[model samples]
Target: MRLFIRLLLIPGIVGWLLGGCSEKIDPKPATYSQLLTGTDKKSWKIVSYQVLDNGNASSVIPAQSGLDACIADDILTFYADAEHKLEVSQNAIICYPNEPDIYVTDTWTLFNANASLEFYLPVLNGKFPWTIKNLTATVLTIEYYFPDINASYRFTFNSTTTK
Candidate 1:
């Protein structure tokens, strides 16, 4: 009876030790590109736009800057494709009723070691470049300099969807 009990205890201890040695699989961390475009696409909405003077915040959006309230409803989406497509949509409230809901479809590029971005701006009729200040799974911040005004503008966006 003592020998049989020892045999059963040996198998249980061996099994427990084997289970402890098993490897755990963890999901891979997302890359910078993946954070911007998610698996295939990502949508973002403007949270705050700030005017910086000499690296200091001078003014804010809406009341201070007199920015149209409708601008907050706009959605910007980035697609992970060969062209790096971008789409801007006027969501909820349309700033300009005469304009279409889909405001613009343009190509975007990430350069400067993925620290900067360049995209077409229909309003300016030229390519606009911005420095990527910060990017995370839920937030993105970008800065643009206006040489004429001698000021920098920072735009912060909140992620609406990662699809």
Candidate 2:
């Protein structure tokens, strides 16, 4: 009886260990260029941008400290053709009715192999690299490395609420 019991237990344990080995993991990324720039062309807002240095969290800029009215109504729009735009609005108190709003158009791309984002700002001379932490229809999270500051900046975004 002991011998038979030992035989059954050995087979069961071996089968359990080898069961998952044959199954392969899919290498394709869940988030792609098509997903980032959806068909509807929805706009996204900067919900928050936090900087993590040595495991400490902090806001990137002074405006991010508080939802100052000056940069309150900022919106980002991304298109499928690798073009994006940032629309910035100033506080109504400071902005005159005839004052022109700020609109910045730039080129952006995603390297699917490494799951990183590259922004080619016309204003800037070089490309900015950002590793995508998470991406979805409603939210987008990215990490950027600032060599000068030696800190990793993470930016979180949420879909804008359209009127």
TM-score of each: 0.72, 0.58
RMSD in Å for model 2 = 10.2
In candidate 1, stretches whose alpha carbon ends up further than 4 angstroms from where it belongs are 1-27, 59-66, 112-114, 120-126, 147-150
Candidate 2 residue runs with Cα over 4 Å from true position:
1-31, 59-68, 82-102, 120-127, 161-163
List clashing residue pairs in candidate 2. none
What are the per-model C-alpha RMSD values against the true structure?
4.5, 10.2
Candidate 2, residue 56: Cα displacement in angstroms equals: 2.3
How many steric overlaps are in each model, in order?
0, 0
Whole-model Cα lDDT per candidate? 0.79, 0.63
Which window of 10 residues has the lowest lDDT sum in candidate 1?
60-69
lDDT (C-alpha) at residue 95 in model 2? 34
